[model samples]
Target: MTALHCDGSLTADRASYGGIIRDDNSVLGMELLAILRGVTLCIQKDLLRVSIRSYSKLAVDILNGIVSCPWSLQALKVRITSLMEQLQRKEIRHVWRELNQPADFVAAIDTGDGESFFYPPDFPLDLVELIKNDSDRKTYFRTPSH
Candidate 1:
């Protein structure tokens, strides 16, 4: 369909930089939590429709920016404490930076493009695919609620 074609062309894979990488573990973790929530929202929103095509990638880029930081653990503790007090949010993960990079990269860039030219990398795949595949089988948000 004309609309589907247009939407497909402007998918989440077109996002830009994830954000200023912060090495703080606490802040990075909290940021990651926010990002995960945002990503879930995107998946549920059925963005691959003509309705949001024009601003789709920007949405994704912003989400990636929130979740993919490289802040330090000490800085993270202070940052997370301040963020929690300010936003009333909590930090969830305590994982290493290397473990999170793939998710970060996929969200910020299309995996199909290949990395040499920053087109897309073969080693890294889209995290959205994982989310879509793992989603509830009978509950696509795009479908009319029963």
Candidate 2:
């Protein structure tokens, strides 16, 4: 089984989405983009069984058909559904941000308007550390907002 964590980040003037840095300013859009990218990657690599984790409940709900996809996202919804049908087994789940730190870190990286695909050997040190901690099942505490 292939396990993937997906996330998206948005700021007032910029966005890092789906391993690609772009001008897309919608958070939910970015979240869906991440899932799409992850799912596509899995299919391309012939990973037939997959578990996808995302911190965006809305994105998870949309993918799971528990909620209606927004009009603006209909195309993305269709594409994701089409890709998911190719998988032999798949699960898309909503998780808390703390539990998805590695993906969040990747989503927050500035790739200078380009996409990044990190093979294990090419992962940034910080992301590598995060992945190690995740594999070790280390707990992360969420800090309260000011």
> Which tens-of-lDDT digit does each residue in 30-117 have in candidate 1?
5544444443444456432211111223223333244433433334334433433333223233333334444444446644664332
Show model 2 residue runs off by greater than 4 Å.
Answer: 1-25, 142-146
Q: Would you estimate the TM-scores of all the predictions?
A: 0.25, 0.78
Residue 3 accuracy (lDDT) in model 1: 19
- lDDT for 106 in candidate 2 is 87
Task: Tell me each candidate's RMSD, in Å, in order.
Answer: 18.8, 9.5
Q: How accurate is candidate 2 locally (lDDT)?
A: 0.87
For residues 1-146, could you state the per-residue lDDT of candidate 2 as single tens digits? 22344689899998886643443226789899989999999999999899989989988998899989888889998999999999999999999987899999988988888797778989999999999998999987778889
What lDDT does the true structure give each of the candidates?
A: 0.38, 0.87
Model 2 C-alpha RMSD to native: 9.5
Query: Following a full C-alpha superposition, what root-mean-square deviation does model 1 have from the true structure?
Result: 18.8
